[model samples]
Target chain A: MSEDEIEAAAGASVDPDARHAEKMRKKKAVRDKILATKTVEKGLIIVHTGKGKGKSTAAFGMVFRSLGYGLPVAVIQFVKGAWETGERFALERFGDLVSINAMGEGFTWETQDRQRDIAAARRAFETAKDLIRAGEHHLVLLDELNIVLRYDYLPLQEVLNFLTTEKPPHVHVVITGRNAPDGLIEIADLVTEMEMIKHPFRSGVKAQKGIEF
Target chain B: MSEDEIEAAAGASVDPDARHAEKMRKKKAVRDKILATKTVEKGLIIVHTGKGKGKSTAAFGMVFRSLGYGLPVAVIQFVKGAWETGERFALERFGDLVSINAMGEGFTWETQDRQRDIAAARRAFETAKDLIRAGEHHLVLLDELNIVLRYDYLPLQEVLNFLTTEKPPHVHVVITGRNAPDGLIEIADLVTEMEMIKHPFRSGVKAQKGIEF
Candidate 1:
C-alpha cells in the first residue's frame, strides 16, 4: 500500500477518547499484574562445571546482570588472584554494591603452598558467610570455588551447608569450577556440568583478548 | 549533639547545577577514558558439555539475559526436541526473537535413527546460518549443536566455516553438547571445556522438576 493510503486507512476511524481510555485500561491491567508478580523471588544456586570452558566467565556475566539491577553482589575468586585489570576498574564503578577479595598470590602453583591456599579460602568464606547470613547481597559469585573442595582445602559438607542453609532466600549463589561436589548438586537449585568435547587450548589457540580473561 | 544540630553540622550549601554537572562530567569522562581502557566485553562461546547435566538450561540463562536486552536471538536444538515449559512459556513472551523447532522426537537413542537426526540438524542450521551471518542478532545459542558434529550427523568443517567465516563480528555463538569437535575449538574465539568431576545420576538423584529440565 502507498504511504498516503496506509495513513488514511489507519485513520479511517476517529475515536480518540474511547481508544485512549481503552489503552489506559489495558495498560493498567498489565502494570498491575507485573507489580503484583514482581515480589522478592527465590534465590538460586548456579553450579557451573565441566571439561568445556567459560564457567567462571559465565558466572561473571550473571554478576554483571545482577549488578545491572543495582543489586548488591559479592565475588570470591578461589583459585585466581591475578589482580586482573577488569576487577580493578569494576571496583571503582560498582563501589560498595560489589565486594571482591582475591588471594593476591595468583594460582596455587605460583605460590606452591597448600597452607596459603587454605588460609586464603578461610578468609573468603568469612567474607562470604557474612554476605549470605546478613541478607544484603542479592548475588554471590564463588569463582572457581570447586577447586577448594576438590583439593580438600575446605570442608565440603560445611560449604554445602552454608550454601543450602545459611543463604538467604533472596540471595543467589553462583559457583564456577571444574569439579562440583555431589552434595552441593543434591542441594542446588540449578546444576550445570560442562563436558569438554573440544577446547581451543587442545588445538593450540591461546586465550584471545576480550574473549577470555 | 542533638539530631538537629548533627544534621545542621553535616549539611553544606552547594549549587545544584554544579553538583549534577560534576557528576555527569565525571561519568562521561569515565565512559570515554577510564572505563574505555578496561576490557569488559561479552561475545564468547559457552560450550556446555559433559555426561553430567544442565548444559542446555545454563545456556538458557544467557538466552534469557539477551532477551532482556530486547535483542533478537535464535536457539537451535540439534538432536533432542520436545515442547519444554521454558521456551513454550517464558521464551514466547519475547515473540519473534525466540523460536524452537522441537522435532518432538526426543533423542537419538529413543528413536535409534541417524537419518532423522541429520534432517533435524539441517533444519536448525538453516535458521542459525542467517542469524550468524546477520549482525542484528545479539546471541545465537546452538543447543545440543556440538552433538551433531560428534554423532557425525553433519560435517564439522562445514559447520566451522559457517560459524567462523560467516559469523558477524559482533554476534555471539554458544554451542552445547557432550563433545565439541576439535576444528570448532580451533576456530572459536572463545572455547569452554566443561569437565564433569561429579554427577548426581551416579548418586541416584532422579531428575526433579525445577532442578533438572
Candidate 2:
C-alpha cells in the first residue's frame, strides 16, 4: 500500500487511544481468568531441537535468563569441543553460579572415531547426571546432547530415566541439539523445534563470532 | 542399556585418541576448504517467528551476544509495554552503547483500541527507521514488530522498504514476533520459525519473571 493509503487506513480507526484502552481492559479480564486458573509451579524439561540453528544459542540465553533470577546453572557441552565461545566468556563472569564444561572433542564428523566420541559423550553424561543429582544447579543445560543421543553414544533410556527419577523437582533441564528423539519429546514439558526457513550459511556465508558462537 | 552395557559399548573402540586425531585432521581439511570458499560479508536481516515461544528471548540473547563483540545495539520494543525487563535492566548497564525504547503501552489485548495501537506502532516504527538510518548501531532488534505488523498497526510495505533500501551494509537487524509476513520472510537472510511442539502454559503454569520476560 502507498504511504497515503496506509495513513488513511490507520486513521480510519476512531479514537485509537480510547479503543485500545477498552480493548486492553477486556483483554486483562480474560488474561486474569486464565492466570487465575494457573497455580502450579515446578521445574521444566525444555528441549530445543530441529534442523534450524539457535537450539544451543537459545539454551544459552536461558542460562543467562536463569542467572538474572540468581539461579545457579550448569552447562555441559557434549560436542562443541574446546573452541573459544563468546557465551563461556560472557557467562563465566558470574563466577560460582555458572559452571561450563565442554566435553566432546567436537562434532561427530569432526571427531570421526566412533569409540572416542562415545567415550567423550559418556563422560559428559556423567557430568550432566552429577549436576542434576547435586541439587545445587537450578538450571542444567545439556548442549548438543541430542547429537550424542542421535549417534547412540548415550542411550535414550538412561537419559529418560535420569530426567524422570533423579533430577530435583525444582531444577529445570534444557537438552539441545538437532533430531531430538521421539521418546525425549514425549517426556519433555516444553519442546521447541526451530524450523530453518532460510540460512545465510547455505548461501556461502561463514558464521560470525558473536552471531553464531 | 544398562551401565555395564553402556560402558562396554563405549569401550569397544581401540586407540580412540589416535583415531579421533586422524578423524579431526580429515574433518578440518574439509572445513578449511569450505571456510576458504566463503569470502563475502554483508548485513543480514534475520527473523524469528512462529507459534512457539523464545522469539523475543532469542532476540534478547542476540543483544547480549552482540555486546560480547563490543558492538553497539538498538532495541526498540513495539508491544511489550513499560514493564521492567531483566534484559532492559541488564543491557542498559552498558550505558550509551545500547538504546532500548519500549514504545507500546502494552499488548494489543491490553491496550484494546486499534487506533491507539496503530499510533503507538507508528511512533515505534519512526524510531526504528531513524536507528537504521543513523548507521550507528551494529545490531538493531525490532522486538514484537511482527505482532504489530500482523495486526496491521504498521504498514508492512514501508517496513520492508526501509529494511531493503536504507539499512546499513554491516548492521544486522533481527525482527522477532509470531506470524511474520511473507514479504518479511522472503527478504530475511535467516528466518527461524520457533515451532511449538509443547508448552508449559498448557500445563497451567504462569509466565515467570526472569524466564519469560
Candidate 3:
C-alpha cells in the first residue's frame, strides 16, 4: 500500500465528509424552522409506473394512514373487475369514512366487453367526481385507473382536468397503473417507478392470502 | 426593538414560528427518502382526542391521499352508522381500497339497542383484523375504531397484536377516538391529541358539506 493511498483511506481526507455532514445539519435546521409555523397543505398525487409488485399495495398503505387521521377517503378501481376479496371485507370496517366503487365487471376477458369496461369505469369516475367536487374526501385512490385512461376507455382530457383542476383542495389523489401517461406524470407531485425487483408469480408462487390481496 | 430582542430573534429564540418552514423541508426530505427508498412507510395512526371536531375528518384526509396514490386502502368505522349518502356513492370509486364496516345504527341517541351497537362495532374490528393481518395494504384507517376499543367492544390486546405483530412492514393503521387507552399510546409510533380549538356546532354553525364530511 502506498503512503498516499493509506493517507487517503485514513482520517487525512475526512474534511470533505465532515463538511458535507455540517452542510446537511444546517440545511435541516433551516427546514425545521420553516415547518414549525407552516401548516402543510395536505394534498398529493402519486403515480405508479414501471412493472413491479406492490404499486397498489403502496397506495393502500396511504389509505390506512389517511383514515387514521380521520380524513375522508375514496377509491376507484378502473380495470379488472370483480369485487376484490380484500376490498369487500375491508371497506365494511369503516362504513362512512370509506367509499368504494368497482366497475362491477369481472375483467376484460370474463366479460369480453370493452364497452362495458368503459361504461363501468365512467360510472365509477362519475361517483368519484361527486366526492371530489363535494370536497369532503381527503384522499382518493384510483386503482388501475391509468390502464383505463391509457386504453382510451375514458376521455383523456376529462380525467386530466379532474386531477389537475377539478379536484378539491387538500384532496389528495392517487392514480396507479402499469403504464402511466406522460401527461399524468407531468402533473403529479410524486411519481413512484416500481421497478420489478422480484415478483412471486414469476417465481411460481401464486399470490398468497394476506400478502398479495 | 431592543438589541437583545433582535439578537434573540436571530440566535437564541425558541423559533417555533420559524420551525414550520424547516419542518416542511425536513418532512419533504423524509418524504422523498421514503418515496425514493420505497421504505418510508407511508401510513400513520393518529388518535385525535381532547374534545375536538373533525377527529374522524382528519383521518379521512389521509385516506383520500392514500387513494390519490392509486393504493388499496380500507376504512373501519367504529360508530356513526347511518349509511351516508356521501359514502354510498363515494366508496364505489375506491373499490377494494376503501373498506367500511359502519355501525349502521347512527348515533347512540337513536340506538336503543345496546346489543346492536356492540355487535356492529365488533363486526368492524373483525374485518379490520384481517385487513391489518394481510400485511401488504398501504393504509388501513380504523375510523373511530378506538370507540369500539374504548367501550370494550373490541379486544385491545388483539388490536395491539396486529399493530405490533401482524402489521405489514409498510402499512399505516390509523385509529381515532377520545381517551385513547394507555396500551395503544404506549405502542403508538406517533400520537396526536387534537385539542378543541373551535367548533361550528357549539357556535351555532351546522356541519357544512365538503368541509365537515
TM-score of candidate 2 versus the correct structure, residues matched by position: 0.86
**TM-score of every model versus the real structure:** 0.51, 0.86, 0.46
Candidate 3, residue B71: how far the Cα is off, in Å: 21
Per-candidate Cα lDDT values, in order, are: 0.63, 0.81, 0.61
Candidate 1 per-residue C-alpha lDDT over A1-213 given as tens digits, one digit per residue, 9 for 90 to 100: 987688668764245444444454566676556555544336777788765555665565455545545567787777774225443343345578788867424465445455666788887778778877888887788887887788677899889888777788767788878778888777876666655545444334444332343
Clashes of 1: 19
Best by TM-score: 2
Could you give candidate 2's per-residue lDDT for residues A55-114 as a string of tens digits?
Answer: 877777677777766778898989874234667666755688889888888777775677
Off by over 4 Å in 1: A1-53, A56-174, A177-213, B1-46, B81-83
Order of models, best TM-score first:
2, 1, 3
Q: Which residue runs does candidate 2 get wrong by more than 4 Å?
A: A1-28, A81-83, B1-34, B81-84
Candidate 1, residue B156: CA error in Å? Answer: 2.2
Docking band of candidate 3? incorrect
- Pairs in steric clash, model 2: A16-B115, A16-B116, A19-B113, A20-B111, A20-B112, A20-B113, A23-B112, A24-B110, A24-B112
Residue-wise C-alpha lDDT for candidate 1, range B1-213, written one tens digit per residue:
977677569662255444444454555565456434445344555566555454565566566556554557777766664225534454665688765555324555444444565777777787778666766667788878876777677788888778766776667788877776777767665544444545444443343223333
Docking class of 1: incorrect
